[model samples]
Target: DAGITQSPRHKVTETGTPVTLRCHQTENHRYMYWYRQDPGHGLRLIHYSYGVKDTDKGEVSDGYSVSRSKTEDFLLTLESATSSQTSVYFCAIADRGNQPQHFGDGTRLSIL
Candidate 1:
């Protein structure tokens, strides 16, 4: 099945606003992740979910949060957006089947 899919492929917002990015999967893959990409810093994990109603904060999860319900949906939210948060965000998936993680196309967010 297709691993992860994202919505609103592009966005531009002013700082201090709110933004939610959705990640939808074709099947329940046991793991879903949100990451942000910048120039100097490579991909950074923002948050992730292991199962419905089960999630944990990642290394770079200060202003971000995530949730999952059922098997196929994971949501990432930026409660208060900031210019420093302007980045290309990606959603990825993995499972116990030993397959490497796969990612979505990504969302390009520009905070003004």
Candidate 2:
């Protein structure tokens, strides 16, 4: 569990629709991250927040956005979602940069 929870556990959406995933934490950590996993692409970071309102884009962030309003919540949204965005999403929390990150099981999303 790692004190993390991802909403909707599974989702099936159509192409061009909008989708949002929620990640909630009980650890009160300082860093929260959003990532996606695909067959050959592996896991890639989409966005991350170091603290409230302090977020930065990642390599594959062209279609994703994230917001963190507090230490316990991090939200990831895909505006006008596409089939390429169909992947398993993950949320992770880290108490310190040098420490290993703790991750949520993941949210499986499919865009038809």
Q: Rate the local accuracy (lDDT) of all candidates.
A: 0.89, 0.92
RMSD of each: 1.6, 0.9
What's model 2's TM-score? Answer: 0.96
1-112: candidate 1 lDDT, tens digit per residue: 4657799899999999999999999866898889999999999988888778989998899999888977798999999999989999999998852577889999999999
Compare the candidates by lDDT and give the number of the best one. Answer: 2
- How many residue pairs clash per model? 0, 0
lDDT string for model 2 (24-109, tens) is 99999999999999998888999999999999998899989888888899999999999989899999999975688899999999
TM-score of each: 0.93, 0.96
- Give per-residue lDDT, candidate 2, residue 89: 95
lDDT of residue 28 for candidate 1: 69
